[model samples]
Target: MSRIGKMPIAIPAGVEVKVVGPKVSVKGPLGKMDWPLEEGLGAVVENGQLLVNRLSEDRNVRALHGLARAELSNIVLGVSKGYERSLEITGVGYKVALQGRTMSFNVGYINPVLFQIPAGIEVKVDKQTLINVKGFDKRLVGQVAANLRAIKPPDVYKQKGVRFMGEVLRKKEGKTGK
Candidate 1:
């Protein structure tokens, strides 16, 4: 038995969990999220806690048992408390601004890059260089942050560009003249 899968998830106050066949939906104060149950895995609500079970101990079932548990845990946490990712701009003249649902970036590019914020996610700029991405879905928040960082990834030589908050970059030495 998987250690993680064996543990039960305690549902918090004001949170509602619904299991319909192979689908589970979690709704809380923050928002609602749904996940499809993987094959050979089952979820049940008992005594105000969520439990995950597997049909058998097959190789594939064992692999999915832990994954399903983790995913379900994420869903419960997301709807209740939400998730967030922070990024920082590390170059001169680089800044970020939000106009409605679109975010414009001025990261040394000839033309400013405009990225539209998807529904259910919020982007906030602070001190013109710090970016905060918040959403109920952890995966979406992380993917959006990655997409923004990809716009101008940090350079090894200058260590300049967009980077996750607290992320450390190794600077490369430039060639010396003879």
Candidate 2:
């Protein structure tokens, strides 16, 4: 048995978790989200607490036990408290702008890199250098931030470009001229 999977998830007030066949749905003050359970895995809500159980002991099923519990836990937490990721821009001429649902990044590129915001996610830009990504889906929020960071990862030489808040990168020394 997986230690994490055996743990019960405490459902907060105004939050409801339901298991319908292979799908697990959560509704809370923030929003509602659903995900399908893996094969040979089952979930049940007991006395306001949700529990995940394995229906089979197959190799793959055993591997998914802990993962399923964690994902469900995140879903419950996200809908209730939500998740956020912050990004910082560092460079001489690197900045980001949001117009409507589109985000444009000017990271030393000839043309600004454009990104379209997906549904159920919110992004806020502060002073053109700080970006805060928020959503009820942890995975989606994280993926969006990673995508933005991928646009212009920090340079080891100049330590410029887009990166996560508090993310550290070692700077490299430049070659000296004779």
Which candidate should be chosen as best, given lDDT against the real structure?
2
Clashes of each: 0, 0
Write down the lDDT that model 2 would get. 0.95
Q: What is the TM-score of each predicted model, taking all chains together?
A: 0.97, 0.96
The segments of candidate 2 whose C-alpha lies over 4 angstroms from its true place after superposition are none
In model 1, the runs with Cα more than 4 Å from the true position are: none
lDDT of each: 0.93, 0.95
Clashes of 1: 0
Measured on C-alpha atoms, candidate 1 has an lDDT of 0.93
Candidate 2 per-residue C-alpha lDDT over 10-74 given as tens digits, one digit per residue, 9 for 90 to 100: 99999988889999999999899998999899999999899999999999999999999999999
